[model samples]
Target: MTLTTSGPSSSSAPVAEEDGRRVRRRRHSRYLLAPFVFTVGTAVLFGLFFLWPGVLGLSYSLTDFRGWGDLEFVGLANYLELFQDSEFYQSLGRTFVYAVFSVPVGYVLALAMAVALTSKGARGKTPARIIFFMPWLVSPIIAGVIWRWMFGESFGFVNYIIQLLGGEAVPWASNADLSLFVAVLASAWGGAAFNMLLFIAAISNVPQSYYEAAELDGANGWERFWYITLPSIAPTSVLVILLSSLGSMKEFAMIQALNGGGPGTQNRLVVQYIYETGFERSLVGYAAAASMVLLVILMVIAIIQLRISKRNNAW
Candidate 1:
């Protein structure tokens, strides 16, 4: 009788343990299911939109293909042509110039605006921020149009004001020298708002205690800002600079709408040149090659920026 009771108890204990394991496994499966689905969905989207198109573009770059039809492999002919193209080089140089002229100037302006607007003594901060940020909300094409109107030679508001002040009507878009300058100025005007907001947020997050401590140490406003404020927002500044540089590098819509790379290609950025090549001239393969070159340059810049950010622990 004792032996029989012991056997039943041992068997029951084994069954209970098996049931507990089954329940745990079921719970783990439920927890993993949602993440697995999400991961698969994200991978599929990335492949469809970005990875697949990039691979196809790379393959097409090595060919003599127009937009469509039979493809013939040309084996670096397009790259060779690109290397010999003076217009392409000129456009690339112009893009670099725009990035250089606009990005830093825009960053400084944004930082200044952020500091001014965030100060405790500032009046109508919200309205000021909204007005400053309005240009960014407008479409690039529209902004270009607005600027084009403002900078018009004969009947423009700028010319009207100049006439009032007895200054000459500056030919902003028509003049080759000033056209590039105008384009860069418009880009900076529109772009500064985004960086301003970023700086405002970053500046706001800096602890008030730091400023108070600096004050206690007999630090002047300039010294406090140079040491504590600048160092605190260094990471945000780097991020803003990187993004602004990238945007400036690929400037197209505003340039297109403002000058259309006109005054004899004076304002032509690389993207606009590529667009005209690929769509207008029906030189898809050549454009693709140029695009690949630009892409590589951008990738290198991005890698360098990432390395800098990592070194600074900005991630």
Candidate 2:
């Protein structure tokens, strides 16, 4: 009777173990279901909003689809025309110039502001940061309008000041170079605040011990910042530069509002050219081709920046 009871107990123990295993499997599936559902929803939305539009744009680039009417296949004619278009080339060149000027200036200005705000002896840091960051909160169009008001060639505040100072009134609107410079300056001013915030966060994360050690070793403020702080925040710097560069390259609205791409289209950047060509001129296919080129350029820039960031992280 004892042997019979022990056998039954052993069989019952295995059956209980199998039931527990089944319960765990069900629990695991339940846990995974939410994430799976979320992923599927995200994929569907991405396909609907991004991938579909991208595909249509690519197809449109190969045809003469003028926003409406039947699509006429042109077999790369738009691209060919894009390559030859003088206005396109001018806009592309101007865009590059604007990016080159604005990105570096904005980066340096942001880094400086961040460092200043975070310095040990800094006064009124909260108020100063708020003031610095306020520019970023202003709408781009409003910012542009304000700058235009100040920098208008005739009867502008800047010119008024110049006259008071016994200097010649500068032609900010009529001169292409001056207009581009103003745009670059405006871009840097508006963008620096956000980058400054990023830098502040990055700077705060740096271990305090490093700076203390540098100080003990008789390092000056600049020396410590150069040797320790800069290297520590390399990743953030790369991110700032990448973002600023991309933004500058894609700049449109503010510049359009400021000068209307004026001085007779001299400062018209690539995006403005695309807008004018697509919507204004109703050459949608041609504009799509240019857009594709700009997209490729932006992708290349991002890839390069990401590679640099990875290399910095490895170091």
Candidate 3:
């Protein structure tokens, strides 16, 4: 705390040192203050968009409010009505079925493709990503429309190609079994590129030391994955699965364009049923309630995913 002074027989050197220390302390406090302010602001902004809607949805699900006045009190009535709605039950069943089919398929395909693309540091990485990722870049509505042509019953590309090979033209989006299957297939086709980008980016960062060590130890391909690659990218795999399931649940454009939830609701999903209820029949409250249920299911899955991943600490 040494400080020289020029004043004759007088020096406020110690005072100056104390004052300088105080100034430094104040500057440090100012630095700390900024992050505190920013954090609070960020929290509020997020609450407004993400948390606020969920709160409103929850409130509406329990009441008769539909973004309208009065907010009439009706406890759990909307949920009860959902139970009695046959179409809702059917749609929900189909939504889960779709999730079951698309979740593993989309994520696995993405991982495999990403691994291969990055394996040799493929020179085609850019084009491959651009090509595969193109589907995700396309507007959902546009993709749905294009896919509809490709799978159209009579003159669609799939049928036309089959005819070219002396095969039967199957209605990809018409038959019940085929509709759901094709919808799941379409999801995998459209969604793989998105997951691939994420997976590839994640796996690319994995340390090569692990692989080199495994190879040096004479580990087989399966053993290396069991001990190395899977461990390296497990977190990404979990994230992809979660996102794929969420997307499948909320899917609309493709389903709407493909068969309009037909063959008579055979492939109708819960989200479509919500659309029909809210905009089609003006049951806004019911639609909101149904959406809340879907949100709950997603939240539960997210919680489970996070918990399992954290517990495993596999990445």
Candidate 4:
């Protein structure tokens, strides 16, 4: 008697097809793995650092939480008090003044320096660029200290020059009004170099052919610059303006080092006031409220800048 095997044969073709399917699934998983890791990593970082801190800060601002005590929910009391405080308003005004003066002056000087440096007829351009940029390399606080000495009423370089010209010594960091001016000047000095570099790159990208055509049409240097150079670098100008404005708005280190926000809070910027309130006086809730206000102001300014950029097609 002949007996036949009942089990089905394991063919190579069927096994190969199963293996190919497994391999394809693994390849598809690998394709998605990198992006998945990146997405999760970015979310974790943002939540840990930025989002969580911001949420905590906003929460604290709504409470009367002293640095180490139990938090008491006040429900906008801190904000109401902040609006009524005269010192806060004064500091805000001072910050505005600083931004208004420093931003434009810095931009203008930087544009001029960039134009000169990018000129084909220029000599010692590299050295000049280095010298201009050197101030920016130094920390803002350190620059403030050095300039404070320079502006010293007695035995200072600036005063010495004034005396040489039969001029009286001027108190730069002492008087409130003059202190603000000195801060603005020091800030502008370092800021100009940064804007200069940006302007140089922007100016360089403008097609030389445009200038050539303008020249052929009997356009003078000034005309070509007005009609071509300015328009070409308009986007860069906006960027520089935004950066400088933000820097001026948040100016703290320079004001601190220059005069320690002293001479009776005359030179105090809003940030300095916030620091004094939070750390020195231990008014954590009030200071947090002030910081939140500043944050809102900054956000508004950023939104305005973005809108302007979009309108101008700068971005």
Candidate 5:
């Protein structure tokens, strides 16, 4: 015991422990270094690209900056004028109508395709899926062009068939309503494939036992789909509707290519209006104001949908 005198100094034990802790801290820092660097880099890029542009757009909306010199701040004049603009209101109304029609049409088509593709009695699923999904792969502009040709009043395949059948040719180009209808159908046809893919994934994840149990209970095909399949895929349905609504509201390229917002601007949508105002008319600040309003509308829709989804989930 007395000979334990110099085994080691108490201070030496504490020094060694401190050194060990320093080594562990260094090791921990090394482990975190890569992730920290990547996160910082991503944040910087996001701020530079997205956040900065958004802030700049907001600033432009408050000023009379016509994409030119001397940004004179006009307070809320742009917004006030936007509220009183009849053209803006008309464009917004058309956008709302398009969204209302297109979203449901696309949703129904996609759901039907998904159910058919996923059914046990289905045949040649691979080929059918490929054909259905081809529209989604095509550019919206090209899709519009293709549809325009098909529905063209003069040489269109549809009109040709109608003529052969001794029926009047539809005025898809000259009549605003018919043009808008064609645009709606085109949008649904082009967008359905993408939503179908989403529904397919959701349907696949549904528990097979529920369907089997429903069958055992003598549930018919329609009953099984209405009760079991639809309820199980509610979340996906909500997602598809939200996406379709947003896309329809912001539709520009397809409609522009198809009808040029034509038949005397009767089919022009909000986005097309904004584009014409900002670039075509050189009313950058005004267009920015309109864009901000559209942004608010989109935000409101998203918030409402998310709230509804949350409530449904809670129930």
Candidate 6:
């Protein structure tokens, strides 16, 4: 075998043709220098946290993994078994329901709160924003645990209020239907502030010219909002919807703590289901399949949102 290698050649002319050696060189230089450092940094972080876990999950998905001895190669058996599981389907259905409730509701509430606080020269805006965002800063696990206490059957502050009002205290986290309702409510409460702050910043950055022109046209508050405010913050809305949908579908901590996924698994979020299947049940391969199923669902919804929102953005 013979190896021929060229070291950095100081005598060569730099290439410059568009779509040729030169353009490629230019693109390579411009996009591939400091960006290479960033790419490496990103790769390291992603590999450590995300990509490595994903690769492991994928490999596990192809085997009859029980986390001991040799993992038997089972191809798609885990997936097929997951699909056949009634609990898996119910958990998935519940996840979709959670997404339907949480994503849009969170976006609307956040947008409204953001609009309110971001009103030009609005007083107390900073304080209100801080208060709204406080929930987001708290750990999700802690929030779930706290909410569980607040919504618990007998001692819950919520039911206490209902009882004081001469209404019967409803079991917020104990009933099948009520647990899902409470989970949605808790998710919205905990999540809104974070998206609200994003919206506030996005709206604030909108050029004042849009609002000024709307006002000069004798537009009322609603009219100004419809034309100026909505368009100005449309991209932020897209971002919030995309992120919240993904988060909602995989929600676990709150739902798990709130009612342990049910009065009978009626409130089982998909992540909890995956956790139960993998760790609790020692079906790691099955859990991996569930994770892939979630990824596909999220990708489908994300693609739809991006296309629809991008088209709407053009209008």
Return the lDDT, model 4, position 226. Answer: 97
lDDT by residue (135-236, candidate 3, tens digit) is: 877776677778788888887998998999999989676688888787777788888988898988887898989888989999977797678888788888
lDDT (tens digit, per residue) of candidate 5 on 1-315: 355455567759989999999999999999899899999999999999989988888888999988888999998999999999999999999999889988998999999999999999999999999999999999999999999999999989999999999999989899988898999999999999999999999999999999999999999999999999999999999999999988999999999999999888888999999999999999899999999999999999999998999999999
Give one digit per residue, the lDDT tens place, for model 2 in 1-315.
355345678779989999999999999999999899999999999999999998888999999988899999999899988999999999999999999999999999999999999998999999999999999999999989999999998878999999999999999999999999999999999999999999999999999999999999999998999999999999899999999989999999899889989899999999999999999999999899999999999999999999988987887
lDDT of 3 at 282: 68
- Local accuracy of candidate 1 as per-residue lDDT tens digits, 110-211: 999999998888999989999999988989999889888888787778889998999888887688768888887899899999899999999999999999
- TM-score-superior candidate, 1 or 6: 1
TM-score of 3: 0.84
Q: Which stretches of candidate 6 lie over 4 Å from their true place?
A: 1-34
TM-score of each: 0.87, 0.89, 0.84, 0.86, 0.89, 0.86
Task: List clashing residue pairs in candidate 5.
Answer: none
| Residue 262 CA displacement from its true place in model 5, Å | 1.7
Each candidate: RMSD: 4.3, 3.8, 4.2, 5.7, 4.3, 9.5
TM-score of 6: 0.86
Candidates 1 and 2 compared: the better one by TM-score is 2
lDDT comparing candidate 5 with the true structure: 0.94
195-289, model 4: which lDDT tens digit per residue? Answer: 99999999999999999999999999999999999989988988898888888888888888888876788768999999999999998889999
The lDDT of each candidate is 0.89, 0.94, 0.83, 0.89, 0.94, 0.85
- The better-scoring model by lDDT among 1 and 6 is 1
lDDT of 4 at 146: 89
Per-residue lDDT for 94-170 in model 6, tens only?
88888998887888889889989988767998789888889888777788788888888989988898889999988
- Clash totals in order: 0, 0, 0, 0, 0, 2
Worst 10 residues of 1 by lDDT: 1-10
